[model samples]
Target: DACETRVPLVLCGNKVDLRDCGGRRGGVASEAGERLARDTGATYFETSCKNGDGVVDALIQLARQMVTTEDVAVQTSALRVCAADQKRPCCGGGGRKDV
Candidate 1:
């Protein structure tokens, strides 16, 4: 028998800080990322490893999605994990607050 489970997917655009720096532009456009995410049924997020922007939010959203994919009891446990993560700093000492 073939397993029919669908895993949650998230598409992250890293190094977003360099996307628009000084007079230079790089990295994939937000529209493109969103479009790809939509086409693949995945979530899109722009992140900056240097600044930690969108890091926590993406992680939390992934956790929430994972929770929803699980059974009720497992969902509850996973939600707790997400909630606890929100209390900590994003990436531990990145100084960015979690949402």
Candidate 2:
């Protein structure tokens, strides 16, 4: 499942340094990653921290997108679930406690 939001979403596949690190580096294919980005309406980026590939470029792209769409409304789940749980008129909010 994918998280849906009215915000600029950038999907990054990191640790790409393992791509050529022998057979122990099996991971998601690039074609599938691109398909997922298309399906989710997000920008895709393949980054390798070791070599710093696509790191700055991806950040710049996301920053540019955020700047251009700054007016979009963001629906944060903290506000969503808390609003639904408040039974009183002046309830502050509800927080989740992991068991």
Q: How does each model score on TM-score?
A: 0.65, 0.60
Task: Tell me the whole-model lDDT of each prediction, alpha carbons only.
Answer: 0.84, 0.76
Give the true-structure RMSD of model 1.
19.4
lDDT per residue for candidate 2 within 1-99, as digits (tens), equals: 134335788888788778788676754578888999999999999887778998898999999998766534333555666787776445354464569
Model 1 lDDT per residue over 6-93, tens place? 6889889888888779967866689999999999999999988789999899999999988877765576678889999999866786
TM-score of candidate 1 to 2 decimals: 0.65
When superposed on Cα atoms, how far off is each prediction in RMSD?
Answer: 19.4, 12.0
